[model samples]
Target: MPAKIPATVVTGFLGAGKTTLIRHMLQNAQGKKIALIINEFGDLGVDGDILKGCGIETCTEDDIVELSNGCICCTVADDFIPTMETLLAREDKPDHIVIETSGLALPQPLVRAFNWPGISTQVTVDGVVTVVDGRAAHDGQFAHNVAAVDAQRAQDENLDHETPLSELFEDQVACADMIVVNKTDLLSADEATTLTGQLKSDARDGVQVVKAAMGALPVDVLLGQGIGAETDMAARHEHHHHYHHDDEDDHDHHHHDHDHDDFESFVVGRGEIEDADAFTAQVAKVINDHGILRLKGFIAVAGKPMRLTLQAVGPRIDTYFDQPFGDTPRATKLVVIGEAGLDHAAISAALQA
Candidate 1:
C-alpha cells in the first residue's frame, strides 16, 4: 500500500490571512505535490477561487474543493471525511493536503476526523498552522472602537461560551505546531516585535513563531513540518455561535445590540468599480453600521483589468486583484451578512450610490 499523505490544517479567525498564506505556498510550492480543501463560512466561494487561481502551473482543475456548510466545527464529520476520501482516491494523489477551516471554526473536531474509519489509512494530520491578525491582536485583541468592542464581546459570549479574542488567541496558539502572526506590514517594527513576543508567550514551548505579511513564508516553512495529525493536540490547550447541522440555522440569533436573525444578505453586481474610493466608502458604511460581519466578492474595477477581490470582517477590509473575471460580466458581486431584520434597502442604496 502507498504511504499515507500528511495533511496540514490551516486555521484562523475570519480575515486572518489563511487563504493568502495558502496561495503563497501553492505558487512557490517546492517539488512536493499538494491538494487543498477550503471551507468558507460566508455564502460565497471567493476564498476558494483565490486559492485556485494562483497561476501556479502545478494545480489541476480538480485539485481544490470548497465546502461552505454552516460551521465546520459542528459539521466536519458530515462534510470533511467524505471529501478527504474523494481526494485520496484521485488518480494523481497529492503528496500532501492542506485543509483551511472557516474563520469561525474550531480545529479540534476537524483534527479528530483523521481518526475516523476508512480514511485514516490514506491520510494523516501533519500539523495545525494557525494564522493571527497581528494588527487586530495588537489593537487590544479586538477592534478599537466602543461599538467594535461591544460587538466582539457579545459575539464572544454568545459563541463557545463567548470565547474572548484573548482566549481564542490562546486556543489557536496552544494547538499549533507553528503559530504564524500575519499582517506584520500593518504594524511598525517595534509593534510586530512586541506582538511576536506575546504570541511566543502564549504558544506551546519550542513552537516556532514567524512574522508574515500576506502569508509570504517560504513553502518549506508551511509544509514539511511533519507535526503528525494524531498527536494529542488536546493536551496543547483550549477554546461558536448556535448554528445548524446542514445548512441554515433554525434559532433566532442576536449578538451585541443587533438581532442576529434580522440580518440581511444581498449581492451588489456593478460591472467594474470605476472609483475604488466610491466603493470603499460604501463598504465602510456597512461595516461601521455594525450590522455586517462578513463581506466578500469579486470587483470589476475601472482602470484595473484584473478582477479586484474584496473581503471585510468587522472593521478590517482587504482587497487585491486576483485574476480577470474572464468572459463573465466584470461587475462586482458582494454578499453582506448582517444583523437580523437588517435594512437591505439601505445597503443596496448605498452600494449602488
Candidate 2:
C-alpha cells in the first residue's frame, strides 16, 4: 500500500490571515503539486477568489475547492469527506493537501474526521496551524481585557462570562500544533511580545508560538510536521469537550444552532464609489463603531479598471487592486461578519453616506 498523503489543517479566527498564509504557501510551493480546500462561513467566496487571483502557476483554479454551504467542521460527512475523496481519486494527485477551515470552526472536530474509514488509510494529518491576529489580541478584541477576565473567573468560580468569540478563539488555540502570531507589523515591539506570551501560555504544552508579519513564514517551517493530530487530539484540551465527544458518526446539530444565532453575516452592496479614500474611511468607522469582526470583499472604484479588494481585521484595513473587473458586474460588494446585534441597515446607510 502506498503511504498516506500528508495534509495540513489551517484554522484561525476571522481575518487572522489564514488565506494570506495559504497564498504564500501556494506561491512558494517550489514545484510541488499542492491542492487547497477552503471553507468560508458566508455566501461570498472572498478568500477563495483572493487566492485564485494570486495567478500562481502551480496553484490554479482547478486545484482549489471552496466549501461555502456551511462550516466544514459541522458538514464533515456531507462536504469534507467527499471533497477529500475527490482529491484522492484524481489521477494526477497532489503532493500535499491543505484544508483552510472557516474562521468560526473548531479544529478538533475536523481533525477527528481524518479517522473516517474511507480517508483514514489514505491521508495523515501533517499538523494543525492556528493563526492569531496580533493586533486584535493586543487590542483585547477577543476579550474585554484578558487579565480582568482571568481574575474575575479566578475570584468567582461560578462566574462564567466567556463570550462566543473568546471561547472560539481559545478552542482554536487549544487544538493547534503551531500557533502563528500574524500581523505583527501592526503591533509595537512591546505589544507583539505581550500578545505572543499570552498565546504561548494559552496553547498546549510543547506547542510553539511563531511571530509572523504579513503571513510570511518559510514554507518548510509551516508544512510536513507529521503530527498525526487525529490520534493526539485526546490530549488537547478544548472547552467544549464535556458537551461533545468524538463520534465520527454523529452529526453536529449543536454547531449549526450555535453559529447561526451567535454570529450573523450580511452582504452589503453598492454602486461604484467615486471617492475611494472617503469610502474606506467610512467603512473603517463602521467596523469600529459596530464591533465588526471580519469584513472583506471587492469594491468597484470610479476610474480604476481593476477591482479593488478590501479586507479588515478589527480596525486595521488593507486594500489593493487585485485584477481587472473583466466582464463581471462593476459594483461594490462586501460580506460583513459580526455578532448578532449588528445594525445592518445603519451600516449600509453609513457606507452610502
Candidate 3:
C-alpha cells in the first residue's frame, strides 16, 4: 500500500561534476536519508570511497554501495538488479535514492534496466540529471549533436564505429530530465551562454538546462522530479541501441561489450608528497604529456592529517581534503585512465617521479 520510492539517476561524462553535484545534494538534504549507489568503471573504486568518507551526516558508509562492476549498464542482471533489491529490503529505508553511473555508461540502457519486473514495482526513476563540463564544451572537446560526433574517437584508436565519448555524450543529453552545465566559473560569459544554448537545443523539449559552478544546485531542484522515467522512454528516444536483444523478453546487456575496449585504467601508488603544489604541477604535466583522460585518487601529504583527494579530467584538476588517516597507511595512490595503448610504464614513472 506504500508509494514507490523515488530514485534519481545522475549521469554524465568524465569530470562533468556528477560526484560534486551529488555531494552538494547530500550536503543540503536537510536531514533526509539518501542512499547512494556508486558505479565505478575502474578497479580502484575511488569515487564511492570519496563519498563514503565525505563527512555527510545523512550519507553513512552503511548507506553507500560501492559497486565496481565492469560496466553498470552491461551487468544489470548480475549486478544492478540485486543491488536495488538489497537496498529496498533493508529495514531502515532511505528517504531518497541516488545512483551515480560510470562516466562511459549510456543512460538509456541503465534507465531501461529499471523496468525489470522486480525493480519497476519498487523504485521509480525520479529524474535523470546529465552534467556537462562547461569549459570543455566551449573548447569543442565535447558536443551534444549525436550526428556530428557519431564517427569521432580518440585520435589513435582508429576504430570504425563511434567513440565511447561521443556516444555517451549524445545519449546522455537525449535521456536527461535536466542538464547541468558545471564548471561555469572556468568559462567566459559568452562561452557559458553558447554552451548552455547548444545543450538546450539538443536536449528534449521541456528539459531545462541549468548552469552551475562546482555542481551546487538546490536540493529541491535536483530531486523530486516524479518523471517515472522508465515508462516515458518512448519520448526520450535513445540515440543508439549499442546493444541487441534476442527477443522482446531477452534482456539488453553486454551486446556491445567492445564499447569500452578503447579505454583503460590502472592505479599508481607512491610515498607521501612533501610539496603539494609541486606535485600537482607534476601531475598536470603527466596528464598533458600522456593525454590521460581521468586521474583521481588520494595523496598522503606530509604534515597533513587529512589525505588530499585529487580528480582530473582533461586539463582541469580539483583537490580537497575530506577525512584524516587515522590508522590507514599513508601513501599516494591514483588511477590513471586513458585510451588504449597508453604507455602504462612510462605514465606510471612520470606520475611517480
Which portions of model 3 miss their true places by more than 4 Å?
143-161, 243-353
**Clash count, one per candidate:** 20, 0, 0
- Which residue pairs overlap in candidate 3's backbone? none
Q: Of models 1 and 2, which has the larger lDDT? A: 2
203-307: candidate 1 lDDT, tens digit per residue: 775566677766667664567555565657557655423321111110121122212122346676665667886787778786677446557788888777788
Better of 1 and 3 by TM-score: 3
Q: Model 2 misses residue 106 by how many Å? A: 0.8
Instruction: Compose the digit string of candidate 2's lDDT tens values, residues 56-115.
Output: 888778899987656566678998899999999999888899988743546788899999
- CA lDDT, every prediction? 0.66, 0.73, 0.73
What C-alpha lDDT, on a 0 to 100 scale, does residue 320 get in candidate 1?
Answer: 85
Best by TM-score: 3
TM, every model: 0.62, 0.62, 0.63
